[model samples]
Target: MRPFHYDKPATATDAVTNFRPGAQYFAGGTTMVDLMKLDVMKPARLIDISGLEKGRYDFIKWSGKSLRIGALTPMTKLADDDKVRARVPMLSDALWLAASPQIRNMARIGGNVLQRTRCPYFRDTSYEQCNKRKPGSGCAALDGGVTRHHAVLGTSDKCIATYPGDFAQALVALDAVVEILGEDGPRSLRFADLHVLPEARPDRETTLAPSDLIIAFSIEDADFPRSKYLKIRDRESYAYALASTASALRMDGNTIADVRLGLGGVATTPWRAREAEAALRGGPATEAQFARAADIAFAGASTTDENAFKVELGKRTMVRSLLETARMEG
Candidate 1:
């Protein structure tokens, strides 16, 4: 990594003051350090924001009604929290489905959301043609690639990179909110609205400005009659998702009262299948209804050559997730 000054701030004000034109915050240093070593993140100064009392990973605030997780909270802490497991179990399971134990130990909850993409050409500049890594350089994945893992929901001619994270998927499903601190003061955003699709500019991924710092995340909880996260990857452990779905259902007798869903591994962002949710709402919870609902979610998707598999896989995965969440009592 290039030479950089280090500052450790104890307060949000201190952290904001330390932000300069070309500086980056250092939290767990798992993803940041990896990119720094690769020369992709060459910040002139590094502000260490790992330790703060109000900033610690605080899962104890979680009840069945509300949940708040601190920014500096380690992924390990979240994956092990009993409350997270019970209320939003899908969120906890997504953390467990990420990297590995050791990596998770060093990865922070906030940093995980801000981590860069897994696009090969972007990660290694030797390709010299990833528009997202360096705009106007052009996208290699667009013309010369087998983009099996690329996006089917959100894509542009410039970049079709997938948002490769698990936690955000469940966050979208539960309608979570993210807490960010900035010079303008703290503000909250619906987690589903945080990420931007590749409609116009594929270069940018989120709404966060340069000087903003994430503090915590809150998810409102209801006794969603049932919910589940179903992930399909090449392997069971230590692998990125090929397709995944998060679904929560409220059932009344043999009918569906309400439905919530968010999809991953097939879109440019946390793909919220709102249409699917609508289709299932006030309808039966049978396999056919679930399948139809899943179909509605992707009716507007535009597929590419290699990632067309995602559409079918996504539909099937959505069905399985719904079935598990609905419990489908006989």
Candidate 2:
């Protein structure tokens, strides 16, 4: 890692004022530090914002109508929160299933959502053709590389790097809103719109401005007691998802009153399956309906030779998640 200046700002305003082109905000440092060691991210300065005011952006609160989670809140804290576990079990499950105890203890919710892709070519500096690593450059994974872990959905000719986070999927499914504080003051955006598809400029992953600081996430309360996060991976634990789904449902007898779905591991970003949710809403809550919804979810999936199986796997994962959620007592 290159030498860099470090600054710890106690307030959000100060952090934004201190932001520069080559400066990066330090929260959990799980992603930033790892990328810096790999030489994938070289920041000239580190602005430590983790010590910001606690009540402002470092606490989790449920206001009866919605859940507000501070951006700097540790993953473990969120996972273990009683209210979160009871009300939004899917969010808790997503956090618990991610990384390990040590990582979850150190990783922050904001940084987790903003984590970079785990594509080998993108992380390895030796590979000079990673479009996400270097804009306008070719994508080595697309040409010839180990692509079983790459994306099959929301992919483009420019890049096929898979999003490698769990919490974002839960947030997307719950229709969370991301609050931001920037030079222009504060604003909020849909969580689903935070990440950008790897189109022409794959290097530009998120819609966040350089000077913007993620403040918190707001998720509206709903009758989604029957919710789950199901992740299928190569291993039983401490592994990234091969195919994952976050399923939340509200059933009126045997009919689905409402549903929300988010897919991970097989997509370029935290993919909200709006189409699938639409198909399942007000429909019979059954295996057949779940399978049909899954089919619609992966309908537009594009894949390469090695990762093509992800389409089927992702669909199956969604179906299983929905079925499991449907069986849960709400």
Candidate 3:
């Protein structure tokens, strides 16, 4: 890792002001430290904001119709919270199914959403061609590189790196709002807008400004007792998803009253399947309807030779998640 200055700011304002062009916020350090060791990220400075005002960004509260989660809250804390597990099962399940116990204990919600892709070419400096690692150089994953673990949805010719996070999928499906602190003070934006597609500029992964720091996420409480996060991978544990789905359902008798769907592991970014949710709303809660919704979700998906199976796998995953959610006892 490259040598860099470190600072621990006690206040959010100070943390935002300390942000420089080549400075990175050091929170959980699970993702940042790994990339730094790989030489994939070489920030000039590291600003530690984990010690910021505790009351402001380290607590979780549920009031009225919304659940507010501080960014600095550890993944394990959120996953184990009774309120989170009972009210937002998908959110809790996503966190629990993520990295091992030690990682969840150290990883924070803020950094988890901003975690970078696990594309081998991007992580291995030996590979000279990686658009996400070095823009304008080219993407090695598109040319003979292993793509079975890459993305099929929202992929561009410039990059096919798969998003490798679980919690972000729950946030997107629940229509959570992200709170950010920057040089200009604080601002809020839809969680769905946090990540950008790997368009022509694959290096630019998110819409966040260099000076912006994610502060918290707000998700509205709803009747989503029948919710689940289903992930499929090569192994049973400690492996990234090949295809995953977050499904929440509200049923009125046998008909679907409302639904929320978010997809991961097969997309370039946290994908909210709004079209699929629209198709399932007010429809019969059955396997056929779920399959149709799944088909609608991946209608625009583009695939490569090795990862073409992901399209079918992703569809099946979605259908299975929906069916499983439907069977849940409220």
**Which residues of candidate 2, in runs, are more than 4 Å off?**
none
Residue 201 local lDDT, model 2: 85
- Give one clash count per candidate, in the order shown: 0, 0, 0
Q: Write the per-residue lDDT of candidate 1 for residues 1-330, one digit (tens) a residue.
A: 789898887787788866898888877898889888888778988888887556554444757588778888889888898766776677777889888899899888898887777877778868777877677888888878668878788777778888888878888888889999988999999888788876556667889888898888987773443666788898998887888998887778878887889898888898888877877888888999988988898787677777888889988998998888777331
Q: What is the C-alpha local distance difference test score of each model?
A: 0.81, 0.91, 0.91
lDDT (tens digit, per residue) of candidate 3 on 138-256: 99989888899999899998999999999999999999999999888899999999899988899999989998999999987644678999999999899999999999988899999
The better candidate by TM-score, 1 or 3, is: 3
TM-score of 2: 0.98
| Model 2 agreement with the true structure over 1-330: per-residue lDDT tens digits | 889999998899999987888999988898999999989999999998888975467798877758888998999999998877877799999999999899999889998999999999999999999998888879999888889999989999999999999999999999899999999999999998999999988999999998899999998863367998999999989999999999998889999998989999999999999999999999999899999999999999888889999999999999999999999988
Any idea what lDDT model 2 has? 0.91
TM-score of each: 0.94, 0.98, 0.98
Where's the lowest-lDDT run of ten residues in candidate 3? Answer: 217-226
Task: Please identify model 1 stretches exceeding 4 Å from their true place.
Answer: 54-57, 328-330
